[model samples]
Target: MENAKSMEYWLQESALICEFMVFGALAAAIFVAVKFERFWSRGRGKREDYVYDNVLWRPCWRALHPAGLMAYRAIVFLFMAVVLAFDLHNGGIHIYYFYTEWTFTLVIIYFGLATLISAKGCRQLAKNDSIRNQDVRANFLKTDLEQEAHVTESPGKNLDGDSVKLQSHQEREEQKKRAGFWGYAMQIIFQTCAGAVMMTDIVFWFIIVPFLTNEHFRLNPLMGSMHSVNALFLVIDAALNSMSFPWFRGAYFVLWTALYVVFQWILHACGLTWWPYPFLELSTPWAPLWYFGLAIVCLVCYTIFTFLIKAKEKNFPKWFPYAYQRLH
Candidate 1:
């Protein structure tokens, strides 16, 4: 009995130490992400590449159009919404007690926001095309009149036209550099969804489904597809979109998990005895190991997605030169 007591004491102490270590790691990662973002944005006064075109423009391929992208986003958003509604109907509203539901809902929100942006972008594209057509007609008439005059254009007129063109180009550059609030929000949500989706699916398939045998937690068709569909839809969108996947944004992903963990803690404090994931239970001596492993897994999941995006950017252009437009 004395030895058991001693072991219990040491286990509690070690779990405290592990908790501190995990908190420290999260804090350090957030600090690094903030510092990196500041360092990059220092001289530019704005994010250099977080441009409107990244979200607004369609793939440069002749077959792709902004309207088609909008339609795709809308379809995914509606489908996910329907799935979420059905899940709630089948599993009850308490299904949200799981992180899977949270991440799935986030992905749905992302597609909804993406659909709106793409629709707005499509309208803007049409308006710009109309303006371009009108300018082309005006320029053709002006050139024809100049040619008919049989008079040489003055050097001053040529210089003025050149100056106007240069100023217009500069204005467009400024516009591109200035990403508005919605643009930043879209990018943040995209990165967060990428990491969260990957982690949720990984944990569900490899860890939770295989080990959990309880009738309540048994994997069904709806539950099983929920685990996979989130990642599938996200990957398809990522393949089609021009948005960038910066490594620094993985910090947001870490913060996202941190928020979920804190939420679970709150729920447990409020008389909830059950743990959504068994590893999250803190009563055991090995709880620290589980927490540490979880942190590592989260980082690994984010890194895997990051590497995939990097690979896509590097290889897609060479493989599908006509269809894939490189974001970088």
Candidate 2:
């Protein structure tokens, strides 16, 4: 009895420590964000102007300077390396005693492949940005030369021909639309994968496993390991989602998460019977309160993360595109 009580005490203490660490990290993130934002809003210096006339090299320089682009790439690579190393160290192959080993292996492989593919795509995007910038500069120069020639032909004539000006404006509008569309698509893809991962882990851990096992069934060692891995993935997803915001503007992700939580809560409240997950059966006196508190904490963490990314962009003006300059 004494040993059992001691073990329970240690678990409670560990839980409390974990909670403190999470909240502390969130607080620090928020503090950093606020300080950075204040510093930027003060306008300490003028933004460095990049001459767009250099057709070949200007894009390359600009692409390299963006706030989170390079940092994100480095972070993802390092994270993947660490995960791969850990997996190798654990064994050539680790199996879950409870869940199917195939399922566990599939998830790891899927994410690993995804990280590799995304890294390649980001490099390509950087290259494409450079090429696109060169094209735009070349076109602008050609347009200027044509306008000057027309004016020189009739010295008294205005250089701004209505037809030419209208055409140029239309072209600019089209470019803007294209960029926006691409940004939206990227955000959708990123958020969908993130949400899927989260929902899958939640259901797999809290619902499926519990429902499948009897009370006497021992908790799967693999399930705990998987949960830890998923948590780390969540952190990565959060960081990436934050970075992807520079390219896209949408509320769909937030809406989807909210709707998902609501659906889960409603199902639980209806007593439809899901699993042994704490949230599903709030027979514990403080379970509902604890869950609601956790939701609020998540919201605050998200807000802080968003602010930090935005603040970083503000501090480094060159990191963002012209379209974002005004907003920042």
Candidate 3:
């Protein structure tokens, strides 16, 4: 009996140690991320590095239009929303207590935000094309007038050329500049979701669904797809969209998970009796190992996604020079 009591004491102490370590690591990551972001913003980073073509949807083929991308986002958002609603109706508000629900909802929010951004981008593209066409027609008329003057032996001072060149230069600079506030928000959210969906799906399929499924944690089609579909949709979106994924953004993913952990702690403090994931329970001596392992998993997953983005950038231009838009 004394041994059992001693083990319990050690387990509690170990859990506290694990919790502090996790938070400390997260804090360090956030500090580094902020420092890097500030450094990059202060003109040390390439403008293209800070800028992303989130508004444009460059497909694998030229035939697919940006509108098609917007449509795709809308459809995805609607489908995910329906699935989420159905799950909530069946499972009640308590489903929000799971990390799966939080990640799934974040995916839904991304698609919705992406849809709006894409639509706005497409509209802007159309308007610019229309203005360019009008300018072409006007220039054609001016060119004819100059030709007629040349035939009549009259001098024509074409002062518009220099102004036209200056105007085009300004426009190009505007294009190269970063897309505004919403664009960055979408990009950050995209990176955050990338790491999160990966972690959620990996833990759910290989860990929870296999070992933890019981009367209280039953697996169903909707629940299973909740784990898989988020990643599938995100992967497809990444392939279609023209956005650069930077490794530094992994800090946001870590912070996101840390926030969820803090939320769970708050709930537990308020008399919640159960943990959503078994590894999260602090009653075992293995809690520190589990916590540390998950931190490593989070880093690994983010690195995997960043590698995929790099691969896409390297290969897409070689394979589809005309169709693939380069983010850099």
What TM-score would every model get versus the actual structure? 0.84, 0.35, 0.87
| Candidate 3 local Cα displacement, residue 77, angstroms | 0.8
lDDT tens digits, residues 119-145, model 1? Answer: 777787677667656665666667667
Candidate 3 residue 219 C-alpha distance from true site, Å: 1.2
Pairs of residues at least 3 apart in sequence or in different chains that clash in candidate 1? none
Show where candidate 3 strays beyond 4 Å: 1-11, 38-43, 52-62, 151-171
lDDT of 3 at 140: 64
92 Cα displacement, candidate 3 (Å):
1.8
Candidate 2, pairs of clashing residues: 66-319
- Local error of candidate 2 at residue 283 (angstroms): 3.9
What C-alpha lDDT values do all the predictions have?
0.74, 0.41, 0.77
Better of 1 and 2 by lDDT: 1
* Higher-ranked by lDDT: 1 or 3: 3
Candidate 3 C-alpha lDDT tens digits along 107-169: 999999889888887787687668766766676677678878677633333335634764586
- Model 3's lDDT to the true fold? 0.77
True lDDT of residue 237, candidate 1: 82
List ranges where model 1 is wrong by over 4 Å.
1-11, 38-53, 60-62, 151-175
